[model samples]
Target: MLKYLMLVVVFVGSSWVHPMHVSVCEINFNQKDHSLEFTHHIFIDDLEKSFRQSFNKPYLDINNPDVGKTTDELVAAYMKKHFKVTVNGKSALPKYLGHEVENDAIYTYMELDGVKTLSSIRIFNDVLTEVYDDQVNLVHVEIGEDISSMKLTPQRKIDELKF
Candidate 1:
């Protein structure tokens, strides 16, 4: 009976093990309009509710006075402000797209008006990597070493696939 119970526990526990150290975002740029589309995914240990509560406050009113002034409004404002973005060795200023996924950290989307050809942009303590092209459809995002070696199992077969 003990052996059977142990097997059951292991089976249940195995399904819960997910990658905890990685996050990813997809960015698309439209050079014709001088605009950029950004999709961000982050991996964290906390649940969606906690992540939302900690960062998104006041229920995120898009029309609020404190919200976006000149650029397209962003959903995860806190994440954008803290995360670093660079394009071709220069800073890339991004607007927000007001979508949020609180589970395992916030996954959101946004657009910036003045994006150009970029070489690379990295996020999540540099754990998520994106390489851009002349036209700006994200060429690839290389999930870093820290995430690959974590105890958590790969969430997708793509997770194990690398650049």
Candidate 2:
């Protein structure tokens, strides 16, 4: 009886100790608008920790007025530095639209306008790699009627897909 009790306690404790380090990014090529729409999903707590360490702030409130602007600026800078997309070997500068908190995660939106065609796409995603060693960034791209995906890590940060 005691052995079973110990095993249960250990299982519960271990489950709570480790947090999943993952982020998901979805990219859709809009044929009508000739644009690429990107959306990134990350845990809010993990993002808060990254922001706090980067900005040296005691606390970051996404809902607050002053902190909101600062958060947006930091997010934009971070996204530009860590996330990149290239179409047909030419780098496309994605404009950071905005971010919103949904439940326990934050969704950031970005778009690359005036993209004529997507013959080949190259993605470089390093989000949360600096903070977490085991971070995994998963990207799913939808172009026309086909879809391709890649998993990125610290060692392998870039992936290219040809359509």
For this target, which candidate reaches the highest TM-score against the unseen true structure? Answer: 2
After superposition, the stretches of candidate 1 with alpha carbons farther than 4 Å from their true spots are 1-16, 43-75, 100-106, 119-163
Best by lDDT: 2
Model 2 stretches with alpha carbons more than 4 Å out: 1-18, 65-68
Model 2 agreement with the true structure over 1-163: per-residue lDDT tens digits: 4333533443344345536577878899999999999998777777777877776788876545255466678788889999999898998899999998766667899999998888899999999998899988988888776767888999999999988
- Full-model lDDT, candidate 1: 0.40
* Structural similarity to truth (TM-score) of each candidate: 0.43, 0.83
How many backbone clashes are present in model 1? 5
Native-to-model Cα distance after best TM-score fit, residue 40 in candidate 2, in Å: 0.5
- Per-residue error (Å), model 1, residue 156: 23
Model 1 Cα RMSD, 1 decimal = 13.1
Clashing pairs in 1: 24-41, 48-102, 74-96, 75-98, 97-110
